[model samples]
Target chain A: MTDSAVMVEAKGLRKVFKGRRGDHTVAVDDLTLTCRAGEVFGLLGPNGAGKTTSLRMLSTVYRPTEGVATIDGHDVTSDPESVRKSIGFLSGNTGLYPRLTAREVLTYFGRLYGMDDGAIEARIAHLAQLLDMDFLEKRCDKMSTGMKQKVNIARTVIHDPAVLVLDEPTAGLDVLAARTIVDFVKDCRTRGKCVIFSTHIMHEVERLCDRLAVIHKGRMQFDGTLEQMRATHGHDLEDAFISVLEAA
Target chain B: MNARRVMVIAKKEFKDVLRDRRTLIFMVLLPLLVMPVMFLGIAKFAQEQQSKKQSRTLRVAVDSNVEPMITALADQWMAENSPRLMITSAKIGLSFPAAGGDRKGLGTMIEQVRDMMDGGADAASLADLDPDLVESGVRLAREIDPADKALFDDASTISTFRTKTEFILIEDLEPSETRLPAGVEVPDDLPESWDGEQLARAIQDKTIHAAIHLPSNVFDMLEDQRASVPFSVFYDESVSLSEEASDRLAAFARIVGNGLLEMRLADNGLAPQFAEPIVFEGADMATPSRRVQAFLGGLLPYMIIMFSFFGAFYPSLDLTAGEKERFTMETLLLAPVSRMELAAGKFVVVFVAAVVAAVLATTSLGLTFTQGILPQGVAAGFDIQFEPEAVMLTAVLLIPVSALFAAVLLGVALLARSFKEAQSYTAPLQFIVILPAMAAMLPDLEAELHLAWIPFLNVSMLMRELLKGNYLWDFFGITMLSMGLLTLLTIWGASLIFRRETVILRT
Candidate 1:
């Protein structure tokens, strides 16, 4: 991916959440980043490190506390609906209605995204095939967690959004199920979709992300390619992550 | 912005709500089943109480001198008024001995009689106080003691005595002690002063339904021409049934008084008609429907309005605060549909629930009146029939009322962080609606233009008037217009709340 193909830009993106104890906690501070088309960008952080908060801002689920974010040249805050229409969001805890079947959940979301009935059905079939979800025909509650996650992913992309924001998308899956998500993200990146994923797993970041940022305590500690990060810090990415945290 | 998106959200919400077993039971099944069971239970309870009260017998203790007079009067009264009243008396021992009787023996006999009446003395001791001694003691006690004048002047003593007597009547008497054969409850205390204003006040206070004061010389008064006897009755205005019973007793008294007068005149060989020249006829103009409407009008509206709050309660909580708690609100907000569309979609569900509950409650009430849930002859004179068109119009009026309820509840519920918090906030709303809704049941409230604009009160009045087959177009129009305007305002307010992301995602 070239610089000219960058589809998402976050410049000095900051989010300071006000705590109930009359103190301000910096969720994301002075963070600047960019993601090119056809590139998978992974944000690595421990819990409460502003990864999800930043992703939420990028997806227009939340307005940034400060700074600017744009998706496909549309400002997240000012043109939120347009940005929302352009991005598909998925998260581990994000759920499908347990009462609605996989098809029904997809169709409902498809309609919400303003897709026609024929288009919604076609997209459901296509995504179901891509995710290997043909066996799941009942309500989400009756399905395995992995099956439900597949349905979740299908619902997220049913509208064929140009950008995808996934927060710990494979946080709870077994080996094969996690591989399915990793492979899906690679496919999305290959299809020229800009994907920003948040996860704590070093292997997922090593295996999938082309460019990455390591955020610790709401500040980006590292922003570079994998080889560049390894060469600068250490041979092992996991050890390098520990060294950065220790040095901070 | 698309209609399809709203429908999708609504359909998903419906499915989600229905799948929640607790909510499904509360929303749909509860209203369907609770009404019939509740009404039938209440009706059965009322019938049981009435039957129990009718079958109950009261016991009375009478002095011997008063016994002869009271017995004859009671017997005549009972004979004249059958099924409603029955009287039997127990001989009461007096506090003093009769003139020319053994003073010590009378005192001992009276003490024994008191103990026996209280179930403390042995049967052998009670058998020793002969009937003649007990009778003489009763007659002697009737003669007022001059020495007791000073004691009667002491207010504290009098009050204490009265209190003690009241306690004895309430606590010490056996269940069968006051057997009147029928269920006539003779008041524990009867007024002696006979002041008209006091009697009226007592009646207003529900102290005595009717007090029969036998003049000291009632027989002599009947024999002489210019002797006038006065009897006072006290009843509560709030107890309409008691007032009706009192009126019947007064009419019977008047008939007996006239009979006595005719007998006196006939003994002098003059015609009974000469004693009474005027006759009057009495008629009650209130129809059965009007009477039934008066009762049911107030209750129905209060119930409908109050129940509308409950109908909107869970959905409002689930759709707003519950969604926030479940962490699904953020996703919903991210949907392309505007906040107004989301609010409208949720408001539709809650409003439908409210309207259905209101319609069901009103329909159940109508069934109660029509299907003889009450005694056949209790409200028999009232002809209350709900016209389909009238009911439909009322339901139309309720649509706005329900919308207003749903919108207000949703807006308030959204302000809370959790379902429990929302419930705490919204529970008092029922009381707020119930009080004013019950105002239409007030007897003197005529359908006035100004009153028609009052929230809840107007609906109650119109429903009552409509049930009585009185269509006041001006009142109906004003009420509908007021309710509509209020509902629109509330909806606008709810929309405003819906737009606030802070409130929408409060948790």
Candidate 2:
């Protein structure tokens, strides 16, 4: 934490969702964290563990309940448009219009980010080549899940933003597609982009993440590196995760 | 906010809408083909039914007392008319006594008459009249005027004796009413020399087609001067062939009247021209073209306005609820363009589709009237001409109408949670549009200055008057301003909806 240059910083971040009958559900309890440029930050949690809510707040899709979050020096609450411009977001269930071809889809997003025609075309072609999405020139509705996943990945990076927030990005992908996504995350980190990825798969954390936070029942239970976690709770990452949850 | 980004969004929306088979079918193919097919099918069916009705011969039962007179009338009518009229004599039952019946029996008879007039009796099983009963009143009328060779000259004498006479005439009657027996009612004020028109109208209220009245001097008139007697024939108007039958009977009466006049004039050593001093020349102001144009004027605007609703329907749903259902809306929201730009881009697609549909519908209606579907005489009479400039102006007017419709529909559809829900939301919109769109159909509704500023009604009325070759510039200006303001209002409303996160995220 001391060595890493902060790319994302939050102080006392909280989120409350209003429910039916005038009740409120605390989705994220008072939590604070930081992720640095050129490092992978993992928000490891079980289902409904407030991971997606926090990610949404960071992406500026939702505002923080009590405090503030800043992405690349832009406040999430006041400068949401700027924060949105700085980040590329993807979720496993984030959908693409089935009617458009992969290239058209990417070009659409690139232009929305105010990219000129030449840049958009160039970006689409480059991403299509890299992600092997050229085959997705056919209708998207006819594409296999892995093919759709690749197209989704290409769409996310088309704007070349400084930060990437992925929510369970590999939740349903086959092995080959999952590997491609993991590799893309590593490549994003290498490009000096701040990457915060949320996942429940422990192997994903063990392989790619540099620092990790474990949250449960809307509260943070652990916050440290994989080695620090191993040093405190034994070598097995899965067992340590389970131990942390059990203790909490 | 960038133009390039907006254009990109527009292009993508177009692709998405076109790729959807249902949207494509609804927006383009259905309207393009369905209207012509529906119109032509209805027209063909109507023509076939008319031809069938004209060619078929109807069998009408007549009372035996008036059998000879009716046969003569029918013969003369059939000879003069194109469609053949066939008459069959059958005895209709009369429960009334030969002279004066008991009061209770008369009441029962009147009740039976009422039932028969109310369309209760079967036509096939009607009772035959007694031959002696049939000729009793006719014989009585003849017996009163033996010596006076000029009894027909005394009009009051016939009126006096008609109260006592039971003789009747039935002509050109509906089969449904042929089951009723005659001579049941002699309402005291009924004129002895009445024609059938007033009687026919009265009987029509009770479902009776025709009844006959015979004056006492009818036989005298026939014998002494060979003159036509004054008699009445009554019939109902709502019977299927009543109009044709009424026309036939009127023609027969006119011929008989002319013949009687001619006979009397000849006997008095005068000419028929002396009786009719003046000739009437009828002039009709409407040309064939004007008639056709009037009908087209009413129809064209309605069709154009209706197409606007249909054209807006699918794209509105597709852009909003359809995208939401497919899970692509979040992706769209994540794009760097502002919400307003996305809304505007979608609005453009729907607006274009609506305008195109409207134009096509108007063109089809115009072609239907001009392309030989209507008779040349009718087309010529109507002078059904629309200038190219007027059409262009109407097209310009449609832009605002289309815009207003598209924006309103898009806003409403965005609030819906699914395609079916959006359809439910927009279905009543057609009802909202239809009445105002049909302004031209009501010719009595004049296009007032204030009405010129009403939303859909103004466009409808203005288009109608414009197509009729009228250019009401003040009305036109008001319509343009009104439509423009309404369009802006709707677009603004749609923008507000776009800004509502709750509406956009409604699941």
DockQ per candidate, 2 decimals:
0.38, 0.50
- All-Cα superposition RMSD per candidate: 12.0, 12.1
Give the per-residue Cα lDDT of candidate 1 at A79.
Answer: 91
Q: Pick the candidate with the highest lDDT.
A: 2
Error of 1 at A175 (Å): 6.0
Best by the DockQ measure: 2
Off by over 4 Å in 2: A1-4, A13-31, A44-50, A63-66, A172-180, A190-192, A200-208, A214-222, A226-248, B68-280, B371-383
Off by over 4 Å in 1: A16-26, A132-137, A171-180, A232-239, A242-248, B19-27, B30-38, B62-280, B371-393, B451-454, B462-482
Task: Provide the TM-score of the second chain in candidate 1.
Answer: 0.64
Q: Write model 2 residue lDDT over B67-148, tens digit each, in one string.
A: 3454344444333321111211111211222224332322333333334535644322121222222132223223333333
**How much is the lDDT of residue B273 in candidate 2?**
90
**Candidate 1 DockQ, CA atoms:** 0.38
Q: What is the TM-score of chain A alone in each candidate?
A: 0.96, 0.96
Local accuracy of candidate 1 as per-residue lDDT tens digits, B358-465: 766666666655676655655365456667777777777788778989999999998899889988988888787887788767868888889988888888788777
